[model samples]
Every structure is written in structure tokens, then in C-alpha cells.
Target: MSEYDDDFAEQGQAVYEALLARTGEAAPQPRLEPTRRVLDLLGDPQRAFPIIHLTGTNGKTSTSRLIESILRAYGLRTGLFTSPHLVSFNERIVLDGEPISNEALARNWDDIRPYVEMVDAELAEAGNEPLTFFEVLTVLAYASFADAPIDVGVIEVGMGGEWDSTNVADAQIAVFTPIDLDHVARLGSTIAEIARTKAGIIKPAATVVTAAQHPDALAEIRKAAERDEAVVIAQDVDFELTADHVAVGGQVISVRGRAGEYTDLYLPLYGDHQGQNAAVAIAVVETFLGDGSQPLGNDPLVEGLSEVTSPGRLQLVGIEPTVLVDAAHNPHGARSLAAALDKYFDFAETVFVLGVLGDKDAEGILSVLAPIAARIHITASSSSRSIPVDELAERAAAITVPGLVHAFDSAEDAVFAAREWANEGTSRLVVVTGSVVLAGEILDLAEAEEWKKA
Candidate 1:
């Protein structure tokens, strides 16, 4: 690497470490004033461009990416911010369609560090905690977007909508993917309560686009939209996924959008849920570009969906044993992953390399995934929050058949053993799942090991 490249990488790493020093995302504060204060100090850069905000239990990242890609396909300069990055911290703040360059990430952090410290000092005087990891990250994103002078920003809520750090910005369009019973401790125990919290993202007179939600969840969203006087273009009402057929590398889907019927749009992602997400993305773009009245022509729709990519969502990492990795940390996501495996692949036998975070519902995830597994090799990711391998294995053993669960100390060992076992049979597959951290670790390993080459 060049000296400038090395220095830029070092600066980026320094900024990441500084953010890591704050309270982590696992324990987000249920307040937004701190984020607002810092942004105010930075002259509210979030106001520089229009924003499309997204929140929900699952598929938020995929739906957000889809929206950003379509917007970029239409020749608009787009900024996308999503949380719980799979690999790099830079991944969370995207400019146009690429992760923000390391130089820009570091430069933005430099520009905002003084304002962040001012907020920290003010909070300390008031006997309150300082800004959090997500709060500072959100500020950096807005500042970077403003500096880039993007035409629009697509921001995903790091957690519950109302108090999430990203809520400091009023969005032109609010989008919700499927709401479910994940993050019960932080969001809510019941679907209605969780949905109520997520519904907080809707702003006055804004346009809302949502996937098909549970009745209770839908009711809560409707209540919020009523209060905000927002127009909701919901799935199965204003638009729907007309058809989804499995195809090579992804699937072909047709959507009846609010503006018009779009057919045979090939989405390069797996599962019926992805098709639903695409429909929501289409509606969001319609609401953004044409007030939900004019059809997005076939060019942008085709080019956007064809090039869209959602890493770690039923993504293939290896070929000889057909290894796939998915970030299904919760039951809602696990259900989707399991269904995709069943529908998209024709393996005679499957082995899962599983690791989950302590806060996640490991039992629920295992119950949903175990039914389709020939064997499960339990492991843990590098996160301090990861559940221990022994605990996860015991949980799996209690719910699965005898001799179907095995424990390993690391994800590498578990995946190695699973691959060896898969090689023993003629139509066998290996899957790594349970947590986003695990998915990222295995993705890095796969890249280094050249797992895609036979």
C-alpha cells in the first residue's frame, strides 16, 4: 500500500477505536436529545438533503440498500447509512453506492470531534452520560453526507425508531420492513409495543411505505400515520408482490406498485421476503420521485434490482461444499433464512455452523433452524456479547435430535469440521448463521481462503 493509503487506513482505525470507547449499540439510550445537541453544534447537517428513514425487525438493511441502489440508478447522488455493519465501520456510511472512502470518514470525524466533545462536556456537567457509539456515528454520517452534498440520504434506524439517534432528522419518506418480536428487552415484549416504537419515525405530512405487517403492528403504524397526517402506501393495499419465481443466483419478481404494475424485474437476492422488500423499495422510490403517482420506468427498475446486493443474506461463500452464510440473529430472520434454504437449494443434507449473541433468542433461532439441519456445529463469534459455545450447544441439543449437535471453540473450527462432513456426502451443503458478527467473520475467512474457487 502507498504511504497515503496506510495513513488513511490508520486514521480510519483511530476513528473507529474512538467510537468504540463509547457505550455500545447493544445498550442504546432511549433518548435523542444528545444526538440533536451534537448535530445542532454541527449546524444540523442532516437538514442539507432530503432523507428516507427506515426501521423494523428484519430486512431493514436489504430494503435500505435496494432503495439507495434504485435512486443511484436514476442518476441521483445518494447517501445511505445503515447500522451493525457486516465488516468495516466505513460500511455503515455509504456515499452514492460505495462505502464512504476512508479519507472522507476520517476527515468527517475530524470535523465533528470538537462538537462531539462539547456535547460530552455539557452532558457531564448535567450528570448524564455522553454521546453513544451510534449517536456519534449518526452525526458523522450526516456530516459526511452534507460534505458530499448528496441529493438524498437513506438512513436506517439503529434500533427502535422514536428514540433512535437517527430520529433527530425529519425524513421525507418513512419506510418499515416486517416488524416482529425481536429485541424484546430494548424495543418491547409484544409486537404492538414494538411497532408503536418503530412507528415513531413517521414525520408530519411525510409519505410512508411498508411491507406486509402483522395486524397489531399495522394498527400501530396506522395510528402513528394518523397523528402525523402522513400518507401510507402499504403492501397488499397500494402495492403488492405480484409474482416471485426462483432463478439462477437470485429470483425474478413482479410488483404492483402504487404508480403502476412492474413485471419480471429480476432481483439478485434470495427468498420471497426479498421480493417483498423490493416491492417496498419500489413504493418508496415512487413516493420519493413522483409522489406515488408516476411509474418508475423499466430502465431504473431493471438496472437497480439487477445490481443490488445484500451481503450475508443467504449469500454463497464457498462452492465445493456449497457453503452459505446468513445473518439471522433473531427468529423472524431465522425463519426467512430457513425458508430460503428450503426453496432455493436442493441439497440432500445440510450442516449448520451456528453462533449467536447472548441477547438474541438462541432457543427460538435453533428451534426454527434445527428442523432442516442434518447436523449443527455450534460455535461463537468474536463479539464479547456472543453466547458461549457450550451454552449454545446445550440449547441446540435440548431442541434437536440426538447426535445432531456438536460444539467447537471457534467459528473457524466449526466451519472446517462442517465442510469436512459435507465433503463426505454427494449433495451436501454447509451453512454459517446465527449472528451478523459470525457472518462477517466467516466472510473474511472465506475471502482469505478463496472458498469460492473449487
Candidate 2:
């Protein structure tokens, strides 16, 4: 690598370490004042551009990326900010479809560090905790996007919608993707409670686009929109996924968008849920660009969906023995992964390398996956919050046959053993899943160890 690249890497790492020194994402502060304070000092960069804000239990990142891709296809410079990046910190921030350059990330961090410190002092004096990792990161993203002067910002909520750090921005378009029970601890236990928390993103007179939701969740969202007098365009109602067929790399889908019907769109992503997300994204774009009345040009729609990619969501990383990685951390996401595996692949036997965070429902995830897994190698990711391997194995054994469960101290060892087991069979597949952190680790290992070359 060139000296410039090396210097950029170093500076980026420094910024990451500085952010790590603050409170982490797992224990996010459920207040927006700190973020709003920093933004106020930064001239409210979030207000500089109109935002398309998204919040839900699942598919938020993919839906956010889909919206950004379609907007970029329409020749608009877009800014995308999503949470808990699979690989790099830079992955969380995208400018015009590319991960922010390391130089730009460092420069933006430097520019905002002083204001962040000022907020920290104010909070300290007020007997409150300073800004968190997510809070500061949100400030940096808004500042960077304002500096870029993006045409629109596609911002995903860091946690629940109402008080989430990203919610400080008044979005012109509010999007929802399949509300379910995931973060029961922080958000809420029931679907209704969770949906109410998520519905906090809806702004006054905004255009709301939602995927098909459970009755309780849908009711909460409708109530919020009604209060705000926002127009609600819902899936299976105003818009729908008319048809989806399994294809070579992904699937071909037809969506009846709010403005028009889009047919024969080649989306290079797996799962029926993704087709639903595409429908929602199309509606969001339709609402954003034309108040849900004008049809998007066919070229932009086709090209946008064709190029859309959601990495670590049923992503294929290896050949010959065929290895895949998915970031399905919760049961809701795991159910989608299992369904996609059944519909998309023809494997006779499947070996799983499963690791989960402590807060996640390991039993729920295993219940969904164990029915399809030939053997599950239990392990933990490098995250401090990861469940211990032995504890997870015990839980898995209760859900499935004891003979079908194996434990390992590390993800790498578990994956090595799972790959070896899969290699012995003709139509066997290997999958790494259960946590986004584990997915990111295996993805990095896949690149470093050249898993594809095998």
C-alpha cells in the first residue's frame, strides 16, 4: 500500500479508538438532548439536508441501503448512515454509494472533536453522562454529510426511534421494515410496545412507507401517523410484492409501488423479506421524489435494484465447499434466514457455526435454525457481550438432539470444524451466523484466509 493509504489507516484507527473510549452502542442513552446539543454547536448539519429515516426490528439496514441506491440512481448525491457495521467503522457511513474515505472520516472527526468535548463538559456539570459512541458518531455523520452537501440523507435509527440519536433530524420520509420482537430489553417486550417506540420517527405531515406488519405493530404506527397527520402507504395495501422468483444469483421481483407497477426488477439479494424491503424502498423513493404520485423512471429503478447489495445477509464468501455468512442476530431475522436457505439453496445437509450476544434470544434463534441444521457448532464472537460457548451449547442441546451440538471456544475453530464436516458430503453447505459481530469476523477471515480461493 502507498504511504497515503497507510497514513489514512492509522488516522482512522485513532479515531475509532477515541470513540471506543466513550460509552458503547449496547447501552445507548435513550435521550436525544445530547445529540441535539452537539448538532446545535455544529450548526445543525442534520437540518442541512432532507432525510429519509428508517426504524424497525429487522431489515432496516438493507432497506436504508436500497433507498440510498435508488436515490443515487436518480442522479442525486446521497448520504447513508447505518448502525453496527459488519466490517469497518467506515462501513457505517456511506457517501454516494461508497464507504466514506478514511481521510474524510478522520478529518470529520477532528472537526467535531472540540464541539463533542464541549458537550461532554456541559453534561458532566449537569450530573449526566457524556455523549456515547453512537451519539458522537451521529454528530460526525451529520457534519460529514453537511460538508458533502448531499442532496438527501438516508439515516437508520441507531436504536428505538423516538429518542434514538438519529431521530433529532426531522425526516421528510419515514420508513418502517417489519417490526418484531428483537431488542426486548432496551426497546420493549411486546410487538406493540416496540412498534410504538419505533413509530417515534414519524414527523408532522411526513410521508410514511411501511412493510407488511403484525396487526398490533401496524396499529401503533397508524396511531402515530394519525396524530402527525402523515400519509400512510402500506405494503399489501397501497403497494405489494406482486411476484418473486428464485434466480441464479438472487431473485426477480415485481412490486406494485405507490405511483406505478415495476416489473422484472433483478434484485441481487436473497429472501422474500428482501423483496418486501425493495417494495418499501420503491414506495419511499416514490413518496420522496413525487409525493407518491409520479412514477420513477424505469432505467433508474432497474439499474438501482440490479446493483443493490446487502452484504452479510446470506452473502456467499467461499466456493468448492460453499460457505455463506448472514447477520441474523435475533429470532425474527433467523426465521428469515432459515426460510431463505430452504427456498434458495438445495443443500442436503447444512452445518452451522452459531454465536450469539448475551442479550439476544439464543433459544429462539436455535429453535428456528435447529430444525434445518444438520449440526450446529456453538461458539462466541470476540465481542465482550457474546454468550459463552459452553452456555450456548447447553441451550442448543436442549432445543435439538445432543449429538447435533458441538462447542468451541473461538469462532474460527468452530468454522474450521464445520467446514471440515461439510467437505465430507456431496451436497452439504456451511453457514456462519447468529450475530453481526461473528459475521463480520468471519467475513474478515474469509478475505484474509482467502476462503473463496478454496
Candidate 3:
């Protein structure tokens, strides 16, 4: 699609390596100054297109993808940026509902390299660390969208909203997936605090779409909306997932949108939370394209939702023992993953391959998963932050039956063991969960071995 040759995997790999070398997203900079400066020098590319920004504790990626897909179905040129890729860095930045080509990625990075360095120089000159990994990527995403000259953009924040690099631009519309206690060390120790912090993305007069929240969390968002005079279309009020039942390939749902009701929409993703996510996504599109008084035509709505996929979220990546992977690194996410499994599958038992990060609530995750897991296979993922399997297993064993907890040094070994255990019977399933890095690693391993072809 460009002047460059098609063999650009090498270029993509180089870009990924360079990004990994930067101050990583794990070490988030709690300010947007560096990102602002970078964008300022790059002619503020974020201003080149309208945006629908999303932030929350979970479901943001799925919701963003839904909105982007719906827009593309309507024949709109769209750009989407989400975080914590499952397999490749290129997955994070999408154009026209597809991952940006490696050639385009390399070309965009080169075009903005000088300005990124300029911002890095300014920060270093002030005795500060250079831009953290996500900051630079945020700039790259915005710049790429400007070059693509997209009609709209759907951007998901990498973490807490107030100081996240992606907050540098004011979105025309802001969406929040459910907010829960997460990133307590960085955002805050309470739901209200985290809600307020994430609510920072709601710009003045921007229409806000949100899920039902804890009372205190709702108050914080409402307060922010009043301050900004933004309109809040909330779940169970402005919109709702009226019904969802298990169906082939995934599930079918009926959503009452802001202005209209959409029913029998077959979403390829599982779980009730995803149903609610689809509802919010539909509202966002309704607000974007038309009033709530009329719903989207059946063709685009059905086709988009039917084709939608939330990779690494309850995704069945292997067969024979039914290996599934989900990027449910937090307690809330773990709960959703567990519920989806129970609601969608009739497996008599399940073996879990879990590896949690250091900062996450391991006990909280185990508390939810251990109750349903037939056995626990603990292992270490590629992240430096992954908890040791021995330590993780000790914690997991306390919740699961004695002699049911096992440990492996690597994710591949853990998957192997889990699959072997699952093969004991057809009613058994193996699920890999707990961290984004672990999910990505498992997918990578599965592909290398020709495990299931996704």
C-alpha cells in the first residue's frame, strides 16, 4: 500500500526493540508535559481529527474495537489505538480497523523521530528522565492518524486518565467502561479516587458514555461532568444490555441504546460485561452518527458485532483440550473471565494457567479463580514483574485443594502441563489468564507450535 516493499517484518521488529528499550509503560510518568511538548512540536497532530477517548479498569479494548468496527461498517475511515498488545506492537495502532502496516509504522516513527528527540532533550536538560514508553507511542499514534487523515479516532488510555500521556488531547466524546479498584498505588486506594482520576478524560462539554458504577464512583464522574458541563449517558439509565444469552460462536444480545433499542445482535465475544460493553459502544456510535431517536440500520449493526473479536479475552486458541487465553490481569477482569467460562461452556472441570504481575492483587485474583478452577498451574511470564511461580503457587494452594496446585518455570511448560491434564477427559478445559504478558506469550507459543490456528 506504500512505496516500500512488502517484506517489512524486519522493520517492525526493529521498531519493537527500540520501543522496548525506552522507559517502559510499566514505569508510567505521572504527567503529560512530555507528551504535550512532543505533540506541540509535531504541530499538535491530535487536533487533526475528532476523537472518542475511553478509560476504565476493564473492557476498554473490547469496547474501543466495537466502536471502531461499527464506524468502519458505516463506511468511515477510522483510526484506533489501544494498549497492552497480545502478540505484536503493531496491534496497538490501527488504521481503517486493521493493524497499521509495518511500512507505515516505520515511516511514521522516522517522520517524528526528530521531534520526539527534541522533547527528550528538553526533559533531560531539566534533569528529568526522558519520555516514558507510552508517552512516545501516544505521540506516534496521533501523528500517524494525522498522516492517514482519518475521519475519526478511538483512543484508549494506557492507565489512569488524569496524568496519562493520551490525555494531552481533549476528546469530542469520552467513554468509560466500568471503573473498579485498580492501580491503587498510582491512581488511588479508593473507587471514588480512581473514578475521579479516570474521569479527567471527560473534556468540557464532551458527551460522556459510561457503565453503571459503584455509587461513590458515579458521584465522582457526575461531579466531573458538572464541572465540564458534559452530558452523561450512563448504563441502566441512558443505555443498557437488556438481554444476552449464549449462542453459537459466542452470544446474542439486545441493547437499549441512548435513543433506540437494538436486539438480537450476535456478538462474537463472551460474558455479560462484554454485552454491556456492546451497549456502551452502540451508544457512542449513535451519538456520533445520529440521535438516539433512531438506531443503526440492521445490516451494519449486525455485521459489525458479528465480525467483532476480542483477542486474548476468552479466546479459544487451541483445541483437543480446548486451550483458552484471556488478558485478565486484575481481580475484576478475572471475575469476568470466570463468569464467561461458566456461562458459555459445559466443561466438567477446568485447569488454570495463571501468572500474575508483582503489583496486582494476586490474592484477589486467586480468590475468584480458585473457586472454579479444577487445578492451578502456576508459572512465570516474560514480564520482569511476574511473581515467582513458587510464591504464586503457595498463595494459590491456600485457596485450591491440596495437591492440586502445580508450578512450572515457564508459561510454555505450564500450558503443556495444563493441556495434558485437560486431556484426561473431554469435559475438561484449560484456561490461561492473569496477565497481558502471559497471554501474549501463550499465543506466541501456540503459533510457533501450530497449536490451534486461533
Candidate 4:
């Protein structure tokens, strides 16, 4: 723990322990009614804050972070609620551009714990199991934001948007980042089907910003927005990314264009796809600020993306032997990761540390990632959804590649194994990718190790 963590570590641990004891099982399937009951009991705190709802298969977290930073830069006290936090649960909830402090978190839990208990009692009375882990977390986030008295909240959907617990909020702006085939079991098998599922967050009369390029995705979203009469802004049509170039230092940088041009804009994220993400973020901010209700101007836009930082989204953590951590779970995200690795770190003999949830299309993702990886390190992430380490190893072994493939029980072991396999003094690149839960655990472990050193 840092000095800051040292000060509040006990309180934080207590709160986390309480939360863990209350909701221990992390089930994949989510029911809506328990969450609905919890929010209703809390008097719907989600409605108290203005919301920007974002849903998609990829770039949701990064886009949500960008939106939060931009909104905060505009001088508004902002609350950001994203999922599968890389380091801490507090990382999932940010107020005024900062992670909710342990002190504040304890206080909020104290205030909300009663409500949580009441909801649990009510659910029991209704002959139902208690609220699931995510439902409670969503309720906690809303309560935290409400207690903070934020001007606006940027919320990212955990899975498919419809019936998602986060979709409980009334959003003034809805963002859809590149939808693709990922969750076929729950969402759908085809792009159009998944697009329809994700389009559920676009409230009537709200402004919708999307980076969907597929005809199926665009058509589905367009129809949904048209039916709702929502104003829709899309990439390559309303706005665009221009002048993208990577510096020798490996920063994937670019400029965005709205009605006019955004010059010298630098996003520390990698991949050509991030240009679209930045563009979508800029468009969403422009719309929200121009709404005349909450005026966020160009200064915030310039400062926010320029200074913004996030972990495990094409994040390069170490030098010499370049090590990157990206939580690209789905095929769309895998393609983007593969492209980024090809573009910026192509010179290095790349080793990919890979794993996936059982529900995800692991083979499809591997197909996208295999071309760029000179070696593959397969490992099981620390989630119930995780595919077994042996299963992952089997999949990697099946792939026809001219490189090494190995599996391990944990991501750390895989990391170490990759490092050992890397060419001597060649500046080899090791990328930890696959499931978000896996990536987040690896990131948390890495950060904890770094903290110990400090």
C-alpha cells in the first residue's frame, strides 16, 4: 500500500470484507428485479445525477474514462462508474475525477448498508435469493455518486445494455462503441442481434453517439434511435479521426474532427481504433456541453485526453523488455489489440499472455490474436467464468503457429514464463490479453508488487 493507502487501509479492508461477506458469489447471469428493488429502496439515487450511458463490446471502459475526464475538466464534479476495476473496487467509482477515497467509501457504505439490508429482507420476503454481487455494487456506486453530489455520472454497462443494472439510470447522452459478436449466449449470435441488445440504453430524446461501422450494427442502432427519436451521431459521418501517427516512443496519437478540426490531440492509448474512440468521446462531450444545460468547452477537451490515464487498455507498464496489459476480451477487441501490436510493437518478437471466460468465443479471439503473437502464454484468469488452464492450453496447442505455446494456472506464472521465453537482449514484447477479469487481476497483482517495492 502507498502512504495514502496506509492511512485508510484498515477502513478500506473492513468495508471490502463487509461487502465480500454480503455478496460472495460472482454469478454471470444477472436478474433485473433485485437490482430494481435495491434502487427503488434507495429512492433511485441514479436519477439524481445526470448520466452518460455507454455500452458496447469494446472500448466502453476507455471511452467512459475519457468521458469522465472530459466532463471533470469542464469544472463539473463528475462521477464515473465502470466495471471489473483493474486495481481496486474504488477504481470502479470516481467522483470529481478521483477514485472515491477509502474514508468516503466507508461513510457511503455506512449510509447505504441499511438500505442494502432492507432490500435483502424485501427480496427474501418476495421468496427470492438476495441481490447478486453486481446488483449490490451498482447500488453502491449510485449511492456513492449521490452522496458526493456530483453534477454528472458517466456509467458503463456491465454486459448487454438492456436489463443491465446500470441501465436503471436515465441518461442524457448514450454512447455505443463498436458492437460485435461476443456474448452469443445471452445477447445474440449476430451483429444485428447484439446491436439491438446494446441499443437498449438509448433513452428517448437523448443524444446517441456511436462508432458502429457495420451496416448491420448501424442499421439496427439507427432504427432504434429513430424509433425513440433520439439524435444520433456516428463516426466517419458526423465526426472523424484525422492525422493519426505514432511517435517513436510508442504513443498512438491522433487528432479528431467534429464540425471543425481537432489538432495535435494525443491519446496515450494504442491502436488505430482509439482514434475513433477519441472522436466519439469528443462528439459526445461537444453534444453534452452544447446542450446549454452543462457547458463543457474546448479547454476541458484539450486537457482531459491529453492528461488522461487508465490501466489495462493497451497500457505499456515496463520498458527494456516491453510488457503491455490490455483487457481485450471479445473478438472485436482482439482484432484491435492485434493491429496495435502489429503497428507499434511489430519489431519485437511478441509473446501473448492469453486467457478467456468459458462463455466467450476463445477460438475466434485466438484467431484474431495468433497472427501477431510469436509465442503464446495461455493461463486461467481468477474468475468463475474463466476457462480452465488446461482447456486454454489445449486451444493454444490446436492453433497452427510457428511459435511456442504454454499454459499455467495463474497469469503471474504465465508472465514469468513469457519473460523466460523472450529472446535475450532483443527488447521482446509480452502482451497480457484476453478476459477483463483476468487482465484486472494481473494488473492488481502487478500494481501490488510495485507498491511493495515502493
Candidate 4 residue 377 Cα shift, in angstroms, is 1.6
Residue 135 of model 1, lDDT score: 92
lDDT of 4 by residue, 1-454 (tens): 2357557877877877776665543344356777777778778888897899999888888888888887777788899988877767778888887788888888887877887889789878988777666777788899999988999889998889887888878898989998888778888889999999889998899888888568999898899999999988888887777667885543544444444566766677777787678878878888777752333355667788876776788886655456778988878888888887777666557888998988888888888878767788889877877899998788777874644677788888998777666636485787888887777776776665562232
Model 4 score (lDDT): 0.79
TM-score of 3: 0.97
TM-score of each: 0.98, 0.99, 0.97, 0.91
Better of 2 and 4 by lDDT: 2
Please write out the lDDT profile of model 2 over residues 298-408, one tens digit for every residue.
Answer: 999898898889999999998778999999999999999999999999999999999999999999999999989899999999999999998999889987976999999
Each model's lDDT:
0.93, 0.93, 0.89, 0.79
TM match of model 4 to true structure: 0.91
lDDT of 3 by residue, 1-454 (tens): 3335369878877777877889888789899888998899888999999999999999999999999999899889999999989887889999997788898899999988899888789888999999888998999999999999899999999999989999999898899989998889999999999999999999999998888888988899999999999988888988888999999878899988877778888999888889989999999999888845677888998888887888899988898878889999899999899888889988999999999999999999988988888888999898899999889988888877898788999888899989888887779999999999999999888878777843
lDDT of 1 by residue, 1-454 (tens): 2245555898889999999999999999899999999999889999999999999999999999999999999999999999788888788998989888778888999999999999999999999999999999999999999999899999999999999999999998999999999889988999999999999999999888889999999999999999999988889999999999999989999999998899999998999899999999999999999998799999988999999999889999999989999998899999998899889999989998999999999999989988898999999999999999898898889889999999999899999999999998899999999999999999999999998997
By lDDT, is 2 or 3 better?
Answer: 2
